[model samples]
Target: MANKIILTGGGSAGHVTVNIALLPELTKRGWNMVYIGSEDGIERELMTPYTNVPYYAIKTGKLRRYFDWKNFKDPFKVITGAYQAYDIIRKEKPQVVFSKGGFVSVPVVIGAWLNRTPIIIHESDVTPGLANRIAIPFATKVCTTFEETSAHVPSQKVEYIGAVIREELLQGSAIKGRNTLFFTRSKPTLLVMGGSLGSKRLNEVIRDSLPLLLQEFHIIHICGKGQVDETLTHQAYRQFEYVTDELPDFLATADLIISRAGSNAIFEFLTLQKPMILIPLPTSSSRGDQIVNAASFQKNGYAEVIPDEQVTKDRLVQTVHQVYEQRSIYMGNMQKVKKRDPLLAIIQLIEKTALSDRSRNKKEK
Candidate 1:
């Protein structure tokens, strides 16, 4: 029988992208993959393209740090989701459960534990997110993109696997990207990504500084869904709510990137050798994981950091020019770093853990 695995993660695109990266490889290896996620999340939409993978949606509650009226109600939702996840795990009988940390993953991890399935969790940020922290006790192995994250996780469970970038991202065509966007090769291209949902501050600043920016470069702005401004269409500026299949091409075309410091996105930028300016989410908004991620990248000389609160029209414009001027230095620093096959490492770990569990079960029998 072929090995079967359950993949779970959601809430944001960051939580889901790693699992998406894993799908092709898992499928190629003949693993039967099932995805468990929230009833109506970006995960479901992202997984919709994979007709072969069975997607299971469960009810999940937001794991918030701050108190809200819903706080009292959400635990019950989490309990219900746990029950649903348990039922699905029992029915699917996957040998292993692989989770990318998000609130939706907690119940699934609990369910996998209840089912005596080996659970492997992937943490993308320099620090584990709340969901990963909650799930860590149940995980057989916790894979980390940043080596520094090992200090936060249980020492025995942590595996420093680095980033698992999507394979297609490395295959982007700059010529194809320019032709598709109708951008001229005469000017450098600037790609602004605020992540999957988009960044309101990034959108506002980029738009505000467009006149000055467009003079030097062609701009591709991936403003979040419904955030597109129809009024400000410039010849050198193109706006997209999001891109899926064409993302690789866009990444290929970008000479410089201005983005929020999501671990997955920034790591993808690093893998592609793109010089970037990172504006992390402020502590008031998030648990400040992005701040840590940005700092790490900056320390490695892979990126320039801009605190979210300090983002302004003049600062953004000036920073863009400075980063572009010193782009080669950043690229040189990135190229100096040795690359590892993290996807393969994680996959092998999953297989080894599952096999070990099976062997132990047989021995007990």
Candidate 2:
């Protein structure tokens, strides 16, 4: 029988991209892959094209740091999710399991542990997420995007393999991207993204500053699903609800990025050597991972960050212009500080861990 592996992660595209990046390589290595995620989560939609990989959905509860009514109801959901995951793992009998830390992954990691399956979890931020924090004790290895993350995780199990950039993303063409949207070809393009779910505040500020921005830069706004404004359709500004195949092209056309400081997305920008003005989620609303990620990039001269509270039309426009003016500096810094892509190293680790697990299992048998 062929070697099998179960992949788990959901809630955000970030939680799944590493696994996605590894898929082609995994297939090349002759491993059959299965995915376990929430029934209606973004992972299901994102993974739809890989029809060969069967997807299993388990009931998942949100793991929130703040108080909410769902907190009481969600633990039971997590327990059920674990039971479902256990059943799946038992039947699948995979050599190893990989989890990209999200609430949905916690149960899968626990289930894999119960089944004595080796688990590898990837953490994309300098600070470990809540789900990964809970899942770490059960993981055989934890792959991290940032070297600084070692301080937050157990040094023994953590490895500093950098962010996985998808192969397709690198194949984007600037000419193709320019042709996709008819615009002032000579003007520089600014790409704006508010994450998978979209950011209301980020959207509002950008829309408010559009007039001033459009004069200097063509705007391509990925306004998240259902966040598009039907009322406004300016020639200088184009808004997309969401994009898949055309994403690389859109990214290719961008001279500057305006984005939330999510580690996975920002790292992609860094790898592309794109100058950016990052707006991080406020600590009051999030665990503030973005704040740390953004600060690190800014301190290294790769990007400039503007706090949410400080965002206004004048500041936003001025900041964008400032970042654009310093584009060469950011690109140079990005090139200077660039780390080797960790995809190959991570695949080797996965194979090694799986081989060892299989050997141990055979001995026990």
lDDT of each: 0.94, 0.92
Q: Positional deviation of 121 in candidate 2, in angstroms?
A: 0.5
Q: For candidate 2, lDDT tens digit of each residue in 1-365?
A: 77899999999988888889989999998999999999999999889999989999999999998889999999999999999999999999999999998999988998999999999999999899999999999989999998899998887899898988988888998889888888657799999999988888999999999889988999999988789999878887899887778988888899999999999899889888899999999998899999999999899998999999999999999999999998999999999975686899888988999889878988999
| C-alpha positional error of residue 51 in candidate 2 after TM-score superposition, expressed in Å | 0.5
Instruction: Candidate 1: give its CA RMSD in angstroms.
Output: 0.7
| TM-score, per-candidate, Cα-based | 0.99, 0.98
> How many clashes in each structure?
0, 0
lDDT of 1 by residue, 156-253 (tens): 99999999999999999999999989998899999999989999989999998988999999999999999999999888899999988899999999
In model 1, state the lDDT of residue 197.
91
